[model samples]
Target: MKKFWKWTNLTESNPTERILTLNGTIAEESWFDDDITPQLFKSELNSCSGNITVWINSPGGDCVAAAQIYNMLMDYKGNVTVKIDGIAASAASVIAMAGNNVMMSPVSMLMIHNPATVAMGDHNEMQKAIEMLEEVKESIINAYEIKTGMSRAKLARLMEEETWMNAKKAVELGFADSIIEPDKKINEDEKEKNKASDSILFSRRAVSVALQNKLKSHYLANAGANTGTDITDLEKRLNLLKP
Candidate 1:
C-alpha cells in the first residue's frame, strides 16, 4: 500500500540524516486499514540512528495521533528538526513542537486552536465531552508553552482565537525557531561535490531554498517599486538577475 507519511534516511554521505515528509492530513488518510498509529511511528523512529528532519504541510488531524507522534519525536535519541514547508495547523502544530529546531518559509503558516469533540449522550455525556476537550486543550498548550515559554493564559487565549500566524509572526511568538533565508544560487560543480546527503549539506540546502524564496518575494514586492531605483535601471537590474 502507498504510504501517506514518508520516512527515509538519506544515507549517502558523511553524516546521514532522516527525512520524514508529512503531507496531507495527519491521521486523515491512512495507507493501511490501521496504520500511522503510535506503534507504527515508534517502529519508524527506531529505524533511524541520527537526527531527523520532518517536513510538515498539514491541516492537522486525530489529536491522539498528533500526541503520539509528538511524544515519539521527543523520545527519539537524536535531535528533531521541523521545517514547515506549507502549513502546520491543529494537531500538526503539536507535532511541530517536537522539534528541537523549527523553521518555516516566509510564506508558510502556523495555526493553533482549542481541541474539539463530538459526543452523543445526555447532559452528563455533554459535560464529559467538555471535560475531555478541556484536558486535551491543556495538553496542546503544554507543547506550545514549552516551545514559546508563553504564559498559559496568553497561550490559551491565542488558541481560543484560533490564531494563525505567518512565518515571521510564528518566530516572533516563538512557535518557529527561524525563517528560511532568501534563495541564493549555488555553483553546479560545487553543488554536485556538496550534494546534500548529510545533515550539514542538507541544512545548507534548506537555507538556500529559503534564500531563494526570499529573493523571489523581494523581486515581486519590488517589481515597478519606486524605492530609489528608476524604471529603466530597475528593468536592467531585473534583466541582470534573470537566470
Candidate 2:
C-alpha cells in the first residue's frame, strides 16, 4: 500500500522544525495511481521554510522520480535531516543519502541493488536497455559515493550484491549518522498483543479448514502463488458467509 506523505513537527506551538515523511514504494505513480512530482516535494520544502527532516520508508521505484526528488532536496538551502523509519531500498536510499544528517531507527533497513530493466524485440532494443541501465547505475552510485564518502568501485560492488544493511551497519558504512533507539518496552508490548491476535485468529476452525484446503489443492497446484483474483474471491466469500 502507498502511504501518503505525512508532515509534522516535534513541537506543536514551535513548529519551525518541519518533518516530511515518505513511506511505501517510491514509484512514478503511487500504489493508488497518483502521480508524484518534484513540484510537490519542492512545495513541501518551501512550506516548511525551516530546518527540514525527511523520514523515509520505501522500497524505491522509478529512477526519474528518484532523480527529480534528489535534485530538489540537494537544492534546498536549509538543513535537511533524513530519519529512516523502516526500509529505504533502491531510489529511496538515494533520497536518504541527500540528508545533511541521516538517522536510522534501530530496527529499520537500508538496501541497494543494481539497476534492472525489461526489453523486447531486437538487438538494438537490448543494447538501448543496457545503456540506459548503466546510466541509471552511475546516477545511483554517484548519490551513495557523495553521501558516504565511499569509493565508487566499492559502492558499485555493494549495489551489485543487493546489500541489506541494518541500522548499525548503515552507520558503520557512513550511510547513516546515528541509530535512534525507540522505547523498546512499548514496541514489545505491541508485538505481544499482535501475537495474541494472530494466535486466536489462526486457531479458528474455519481458518484451519481453509488453510488445509488451500495448502492441499489451490496452493499446491499453483506453486508460484498467483494471488490477487483468488484471494479477492475468497475474501468476498468469507465476508458474505459472516453472520
Candidate 3:
C-alpha cells in the first residue's frame, strides 16, 4: 500500500519547520479501496507545529475525510503552504483551499466541479438525494468563496461546467495564490532535461492542452503519476468508434 501522507523532513531536528507530502488520493487508494480515516490523520498531524509545507497531487476521495483535513490545516497555529505539483481536483481542491499560501506548478492543474455519489432508490429517495447534494455543494462553495471571493452564482456556474484550470488560470481565478517559480540554480543534468524536454513536446504534449476540456478530467493512475491521456491514443480510439 502506498503511504498517502508522510513527513518529508528527513531530519526531524526542527519542530518549527516541517514538510509533508499529500500525494495520491486525498485519503487513500481508490483502486484497492484502502482507507485513511480522519482520526488516524490527526494522530500524525498533532505532532507537527510551525510552518508546514504540503506537496499535493490527488484526484480526490471521500469529501468527509478531505473536510477534516482541510479544517485541520485551516486551524493550525502556524503557517501552511500548499504546493500543487500535479493535479488537485474534486475534494483535493477543497483541501487546497485550506492553504495559507497555495502555489501551483507551471503546468499543474486545479479542477473544480460539483460533488457526485452513487445512489440507488426511487422517487422519494431521488428527491432526498437531490436535496442532500444541493446542501453538500453549498458547503463546498464556502471553501471556494473564502479563497476566491467569487460570487455564489458565478462559482455555481463554474462547478456546473466542471472547470479545468492551469496554474495561470488558477491564480487568476483566485484558486491559487501564485505560480511556483523555477529554481534559480539547476545542475547540468536538470538543465539538459529542461532544454531537451520542450524540444520533444510534439511527441507527447501536442494538443493535450486544447483537449483538456474534451475529457473533463482523467483520474491520476496513482497520486504520483504524471501521465495523461495520449492524443494519439485518443485519436485512434475515436477512429475505431466512428467505424
lDDT of 1 by residue, 1-243 (tens): 334488877757625799999997877645234654556778878975888889999999888878878888998999889999999999999999999999987678888878987699899999999999999999999999999999999888888767787777788778989877558766788556533231111122334447666766676777776456555555566557543
Candidate 2 lDDT at 191 equals 54
Each model's backbone clash number: 6, 0, 1
lDDT of 2 by residue, 1-243 (tens): 333467785557657788788887675464223354555656766775778889898898876777777888888888998999988988899989889999988778888888887789799998998999988899899999998999999888787657877777788888889877576556777656533123210113345457556745774477576655565566567566543
Leading candidate by lDDT: 1
Cα lDDT of all candidates, in order? Answer: 0.79, 0.75, 0.76
Position 238, candidate 1: lDDT: 52
Q: How far does residue 154 in candidate 2 sit from its true spot (Å)?
A: 0.7
Please list the residue runs of candidate 1 whose C-alpha ends up more than 4 Å from where it truly belongs after superposition: 11-15, 29-36, 185-243
**TM-score for every candidate vs. truth?**
0.71, 0.69, 0.71
Tens digits of lDDT, candidate 3, 17-110: 7787888776564322335455566767777566888888998887776787889889888899999999998899999999999998877988
- For model 1 the local lDDT of residue 107 reads 71
